[model samples]
Target: MKIAFTAPMKPLDDPVPSGDRTMGRLIVQALELGGHEVRVASRFRTWVKEGGDAAILTRETEGLSEADRITREWEAEGYRPDVFLTYHLYHKAPDWIGPALADRFNLPYAIIEASRAPKRQTGPWALGFRAADDALARADVVGALHHADAECLGAVLQRDRLKILLPFLDTLPFETAADLVIKHHKAPKLLAAGMMREGDKTRSYEVLADALSRCMDLDWSLTVIGDGPNRAYVESLFPPERTSFLGALPPEQMPQHYAAHDLFVWPAIREAFGFVFLEAQASGLGVVAGSTFGVPDIVQDGKTGLLAPEGDAEAFAAHLRALIPDPARIEQLGEEAARHIRFRHTLEMGCARLNAFLETALDNRWQRSTAPRRPHQSSGQPL
Candidate 1:
């Protein structure tokens, strides 16, 4: 199967990277791993943070031109993709290219991580929001990352088209790293990594600071990693002597960081599922994160990690206080966390699930004459 991949929020080669960009690149690789030939549909980002009437019209025209250009190029090559797969389709990042190009090529179109909200039909981003809703409605199938998203997508996509897929991470890096489960700890060393932005990021940081301060009676120190616009503000929330900031580390370096730390603690407010939780568990570290959207999917409550109520600093602090002095419990949870991620949340597992869903989505429409589409390159490798 030849898949035309596109992400409206950002390109696979985006410079200022985030979890979304990483997910986009990973999805393409996962499809390829499933023995599908994939190509980038367009690099032009159709994401509009917020725009009024005039700006909306301008972006609409630009999206059409970009889609037309890709259509012409693909037509000239006499190549028609079996399907078009768009990643991260939300109002803030709509599928401005994939839906249009898929319609032009008369191909099946699918989306991953698509969300819809009717209330946004009239806002500064009303145009983009409508476009996203239409794109999801047109999809032959949509892979939802969370139950919340699946419920939301129900308004736009049919039951047959909605596939619920949990947010996942590539666990190979952490799986191959040296284990830190046996590390000695007189005072547990906590670790957290997240960009320090104004909205959710800063709020999470502030919540974490409050939680940690309340746990001062416990024996623990901390290390924070990540850099962003509000570094100074975030750093000020913590005691300078107790916290060591490592700034931002590359994704490749995260496994080692996870392995070096005793506990992974962070308050993820309304997160789809923090990618770091999976990474930390894969490295055999117990986690303490706020109980929010999609988090319970990644962090098994009693088995792998502890989850405090969404915004309860006292509960979050108590969780830390309970775990800080208990090495036996930490090791027990860490072992379980690692095993959980290996069996359920790895990239290979996610790819296998997606491959099966895509085949189902193809339904009876699939035929061997689509054979020239190429041999099934993937042998259904184990994740």
Candidate 2:
């Protein structure tokens, strides 16, 4: 099958390092692994951070123009795709070209990680919300990455059209690092990784600092990774002597860091199933994160890691205090964490799930096109 892929939130080859970009690359890899010819259809991003209806209109016009150009080129070359797959459709970054191209080519349309926010229907993002809603209605199949997204997507799509596509990655590097690295820390070494920015990220840092402050009596050292505009403020939240900042590092250098540490800690306020949690667990590190949104989907409480109530610094601190004294329990959790990721979350598993989704979409499209049509009573036309 030839699949035309698009990521409206971020381009697959974007130089900036982010979770969105990483997921986009992984989707392409998964499709290729399934023996499908995948091509990135467009790089025209439709994300609008802060804008009125005018901003949405401008993007809509540009998106239509881009779709026209691609249609012409593909027709000239006689290249027709069997399916149109899009990743990350939301009010902030609704897909504008995928639906148009899919209609023009008469192909099955599918979306991954499609979120619907009914509250945005009347706000400043009304146009974008409507556009996203229309796209969701037209999708033959929608893949939800976590349980929370699946619930919200169910409100607008049929139950059979919605599938749970668990978050996954290539865990070979982390698994190799876990097998090779031996931790020998004087005090239990803790690790946390996230971009330091305003909004929810800085709030997570604040909660982490407060939680760590309450556990000062315990002997532990924390290493923080990532850098952003709020680095200075985020650094100020933690004690200089107890925390070591590694700044921002490349993706290739992260597995060793995860393996060197004994635990991964983060407040995870409003996080959307963090990839860092998966990476940390893949490297045999037990996690302690706030139970919010999709955090529970990846990290099983009491099985792979401990989850505190969201934003409760006291509960988070108590969990840390309990684990710091018991190295045996920490090791046990880490072992379980590694095993969980190996069995349930991997590139191969993700590829199989994606292939199944494509097959379902194609079958749905074929049934709809071949179904019997009734004539309209008023105009004598096929309805």
The best candidate in terms of TM-score: 2
The digit string of per-residue lDDT tens for model 1 on 1-383 reads 77788887788999886878877887877778888899998887877766776776777788889999998898799777777888887777777788788666656677888877778788787887888888876777889877877888787666878888876678877877734334766888899989988889898999999999988777788999999999999999998889999999888888888888888999998677888888899999899999887788789998899999987888999888899889888888889999999898878887898787677545512331253343232322111
Model 2 residue 277 lDDT score: 90
The regions of model 2 sitting more than 4 angstroms off are 371-383
Candidate 2 TM-score, true structure as reference: 0.95
lDDT of 2 by residue, 2-56 (tens): 8899999888877778887888898899889889889888998999888589999
- After TM-score superposition, the amount by which residue 331's alpha carbon in candidate 1 deviates from its true location, in angstroms, is 1.5
Per-prediction RMSD in angstroms? 4.2, 4.7
TM-score of each model, in listed order = 0.92, 0.95
Estimate candidate 1's RMSD in Å: 4.2
